[model samples]
Target: MDDNLKKLIPFALKYKPNIIWNVVFNVLYALFSSLGFVMIIPVMNVLFGEEEKVTKLPTYNGIWELKTYLNDTLYYYVNYLTEQKGAAYALYLIISIIIIIFLLKNLFGFLGLQHLMKLKTGVLRDFREKMYAKIVDLPVSYYSEKRKGDVMARILGDVNEVQNSFFAVLELIVKEPLTIIITLGIMFSISWKLTLFVFIFIPISGLIISKIGKSLKSQSARAQQENGYMISVVEETLTGLKVVKGYNAETYFKNLFTASVNRLYILTNKIGKKHNLASPMSEFLGIATIAVLLIYGGTLVLQDGSLSGGAFIGYIGMAYNILTPAKAISKASYQVKNGSAAAERVFEIIETPNVIRDTEKSIAINSFNDKIQLKNITFSYDGEQNVLKNFSLDIPKGKTVALVGQSGSGKSTIANLLMRFYDVENGTITLNGTNIKDIQLFALREQLGLVTQDSIMFNGSIADNVRIGKLNATDEDVIAALKIANAYEFVQHLPDGINTNIGDGGGKLSGGQKQRISIARAVLKNPPIMVLDEATSALDTESERLVQDALEKMMQNRTSVVIAHRLSTIQKADVIVVMNRGEIAEQGTHDELLAKNGTYAKLVSLQSFES
Candidate 1:
């Protein structure tokens, strides 16, 4: 088995009950199918009256003579029935028995299929769930390097590809080989000489089929990669549709999208062209091998006269039966290769280790005390260039220590490191006196609330979005939080109040409304610490006034780290720290900073001039 294909074994074992029962039914189906062919000779014999006449009942025989004994016994009954009743009666009985055998064959085949459906769908279902669960826990840093659409494609398209090719390979591997083996055993019984001749071509056909699919996995990998890239482009275009339209870059994106799809089209065509060969090559080989067998077996029947005519015809039919499974196995070989490519991609995401996971000795904290401190932290998003360099600060309890800096000055990185969104390269962030990494991640997060510039929202009601902070918060709690954030008046005017659908990312609401709702969410949680990253920078003057008012109310008596792009928002902060490059250039109270007449004083001047 390919290494990637082996990953499926654990998931397959998850449905062990399904596998065991499916194999049982498949074994029965294979038995009845071969037996159906075996009965063909007797049917032809009874129909043509070529059954050997027996004078008396055949004697009981050992297992070695079972075939001859059974044949004699069957002929004796037929002769007796023909003499007593009629030839038509004996013929009807033989035909009816053949029908029953075939019926049982089909019945078991269907039963096997029922269990197969469960195994296929069950494995894929668990696999998709597992991928989604893992993706959710992956550190936020992982998303920075990956495209949204590519991740979405892995969960959706690649999983579906596994369903089509990999799970279907399961059935082909089990049932097809069993059918071929049983049918070959029957053929050998009629004439070992002819079955030996048939065996000569089996490996040859397998070789041709294997050779056809040798490079399919690589080609398929390229195709799926291109497909993921195309999806990433589509995702980027949708996410930045406003910018794309405002800048009139529709043609640029469309042309870029078309180029990716065109590459995918060519790669898939290469795979399909190679994949298409397996069926025709195996089919032609099957018929050609059969033709050679017919002549060899015909010569034996006519000149050698060792094999009976009825048995010869039946053997030929069995040979043809082998062809069906041979064809299926041949095709499946290619599909397994193709599916292996998708499996590799799926497992890539599943096997990635999360760098931000909690340690074995981690402890949960219920409340925060004293202060949160970042001590001599050095960090970088990209490994080569530092984003924060020995950057240290102290945020005391109930104090709003605001971060004021230009873009890329590491203000937001400080917030991220404090919240454990990204761990610092060389320092400790402690909640109270304990290292935040030593605390249970969920517990650490529970003690803090974050409101980012984007105002992330799910497609749910106003109350539902707020409940994300505290899942059990009642409608009254939601309303109280909203009122504290100065958002309840507008929410009350809506048709459904707090129950109204927010739409995607609260598209139905204005920028200020979403920001206030986010503040209300943090207020409802009532965490000991809050981190607000440019929470009102994107708003108009009026919207900023409303959102800023909400932020102030939410931060009351709570330890807060506010990263402010607009210096005006942080003029009253307990302390304002101005960042330069990756380090803190200065830190003091607003009055003390103004007295220094340095970076903080200049930032105030710039904002005043812009206003």
Candidate 2:
């Protein structure tokens, strides 16, 4: 909890003005609220014939003597009102003063809440922005071991919980303590003996509330984690809905989702019971203190005449006022405990160090001058076995190289390593004769363009999707790029042309259409190096032909590495490399490999037979 609290310090300091306003208004609110109750003492005095008469108004005095001066001044005013106006008018005047004081109390309370609202939402905004930046910067392999749904839950669900709970911490620190202190001060002024008696019961109630709060923290953590698991289930189901329906496995996923939800329900029920206990227990303790005070103070009033009836009743009012804030303090203890667990989860992602980061000594690369080299590289996704073992390749500038192989033969792995999605476990990859590890990541990626089989797209207008390649691209640049990728004709026929909205994941478009738009995006980037990873493998025959033509245009005069399963796609490559079991098996131009009758020749023959 202490560690989690440290994470909130920077956010708190960022909004210090709001913090100061919250504190200032809360103090003023508490002062005004207690004054409302204290004002009742004079009203009661007048009503019960206990008012002290005064012949003259009190003179102004220094701060030290202000209390006495104010008391005498009020009685003097009441006496003057009684003489000038009737007693009924004097009573009306006192009632009017009490109403005005209570009104000011509520006004300040509202202002305090306004400041609290600012702090609550500002902190949430800051946390969300930081979470997004961190997730984008994290290495690709980090997601392999993590669930996307869980990360989503932390960013959306967990951050909301922290916002609510953290505010309780702020309220516990500022509002409740200030209110309790102000109320207690008035109670002490009325009767020190009774005030001390009330203090004794407080510690006992606090100990019990604290005990309940401890259990709440653990249960809250469990519930939040289960929520993440449940969200993951939903996200996975949605993403794989086509597969689930095709396989007739909807029931299987339903059961999995239900199991996650059921665990959350049971844990939350326990948390609810423990959390609800704080209010009633504190309420009961407050009533018990009032009962004890009534008996003891009542004796002094009746037997010894030491306390007046109106003043005694007003003192009881002040003591009762402490109950609401005490209950709030108790409830806040549980909330802060609950929020601490969530804060820890939120900070976990925020504080996670990105394994792939630019070191201070790293230099920036802006162009592809010579070639991209992978020299005797040994790499692994898991530590157990290499995906590319002692493999090497060079992609010279303005030339095309193709990698053909059976699945899991280090074809896609080459793309992953070159992009530094995962760095090599052994050997080196260099660009322009300089090691990639020594180059700033942004600079390295900026010089390359990638279009993959999935054709991932966001929900936005066609122009918005294409403009991602170059953020400042104009309408003419987008149109030219779309024409280059053969996407402009179809885009022009759409209802809104380039402004047409693509549904989620580009669901509104056909698979090949989506691929062309992706190519268009890559074309706009116009990087010196292009990576086409199975770009047209998923398209139909006609779509493949059209997309293949666009790929040829995009690859021209660029350093291109094409990973293709289709033999027809890479027939014109300058070099064709065949891989098997994480090692290079054959290398030559397509026809040269065919003449050599190596692995590449066999792969070509098999494809020819299939065709």
Q: How many clashes (backbone N, Cα, C below 3 Å) per candidate?
A: 0, 0
Candidate 1's residue-wise lDDT over 263-317, tens digit each?
A: 9989988988877887888889989988988999899889998877778888988
Among all windows of 10 consecutive residues in model 2, the one with the lowest summed lDDT is 602-611
Off by over 4 Å in 2: 54-65, 83-86, 609-611
Stretches of candidate 1 off by over 4 Å are 55-65, 609-611
Q: Report RMSD for candidate 1.
A: 1.8
Q: For model 1, state the Cα shift of residue 190 in Å.
A: 0.3
Q: State each model's CA lDDT, in order.
A: 0.87, 0.88
Question: What are the per-model C-alpha RMSD values against the true structure?
Answer: 1.8, 1.9
lDDT of 2 at 529: 93
